[model samples]
Target: MKKSFKLFLFTLLFAYQFSAGQNQKKIDHQTLTWIRYYNVLPLTEKWALHSEFDNRSFVNPIHENLFVIRIQGRYRTSKIIELGGGFAYFNVNTQNPDADPDYSIPEYRTQQDITFINDIAKITFHNRFQLEERFIQKADKNGLLDEFSFAYRFRYRLQSTFTLWEKEQNSLKGTISDEILFNYGKDNKRNTFDQNRIYAALRYHFTPNLGLELGYLKNFQRRASGVDFYDRDIIRFTVYHRINRKF
Candidate 1:
């Protein structure tokens, strides 16, 4: 079953890439290096808080492009379903070397998500659907970042985790995930296909609650008009930590 699923995913990814090559949109390519720190604070068997910080860079060889901070509270209604809401702030800069990388673009986002987790034959599948309301900074007539606009988006991600090697619950695992983003609302009219991300990673569990993930992510995003696209190749490193409190 695992092999069959993996094969299907790879084939789908291959087909998507092939279609991308045939697309007529103007394309730009860049490399982004990203590192993330993630933490979970468990209040009870059914409740938890999640937080994350990220540093992302893109400037050919190296330069800062973005930074992000997010916090979320989650309720696990069942082993197979969970609900979460979060807020995030992002500071973004253009990747152009000639442009000042001062993080001129600041975005505030509120998000809600529904997640499903199922374990089957030592493999775990996770599906997450998210809706976001965004307040994004824009440039004024003077070219200063003093204006803002609102937009809404929807995203869906499918991910799988397989244990490659194990020592009790501490194991080395591999993960593959793909996500698609769509835009809506009154402010966003031109581009419906906002972005897509494909990720492959390896996670090493230090304990039942702590782990590290090293991964590669490919991201494609379209401009509001859907006439231009950005293809980003990202190298990602993440540290994961969790704490459980007993009452």
Candidate 2:
């Protein structure tokens, strides 16, 4: 497992370097902020629902960037393995960061995923793999909704958490995660490497069922042009809630 993890990291780094060296066009750099809320509700010992809402915006000058809503039904097969399927909706602002907001694009996504969890001493590791089918609304020259473009994407994330402090039921934790994504299909010709995100956060739990997190995330993305890119620096604030029912 350790060797495979190292290989995966090395491959991602190599691909990123190769792609960066090939891009001759200017890269768009932007600063952004994100506010998010996530929830987990347990229906039974083995079944659960996960839901999330995220709002993203540009900083400094300040304008809307994107808004997302996602939900998933998850089933645990064992202590370490969980399977999930989900749907997501995205409202994307395709305009430049400095430009005024134009017509937003609508996107629908269906996703399937599996996660593997492990623990080593006080630290926990989560390896998640997901596949997404995306239908993105297109616009004509008049900016009217035209047709829908279809694509597929694959995503993988490795996340870890460490207990920083603990007193009774309340605790403080540190989290670090990295995710890489790839795009494919007839519509995704130019950009095969979609994006990579690196995140680090500090989380505080008032109880076992609720927590708040503040994080910094860096997202590097390749555009459909294949030559252009976006380097985004984002500050994220998140609320996490979990509900469990006793039967």
> In order, how many clashes per candidate?
0, 0
Q: lDDT for model 2, on a 0 to 1 scale? A: 0.87
TM-score of each: 0.88, 0.93
**Residue range 37-92, candidate 2, lDDT tens digits:** 99999999999999999999998678888899999999999988999999999998
Error of 2 at 123 (Å): 1.5
For all candidates in order, the CA lDDT equals 0.83, 0.87
- What ranges in model 2 sit over 4 Å off? 4-8, 19-23
What lDDT does candidate 2 reach at residue 247?
Answer: 63
Q: How much does each candidate deviate from the true structure in C-alpha RMSD?
A: 3.1, 1.8
List candidate 1 stretches off by more than 4 Å: 1-22, 95-98, 101-103
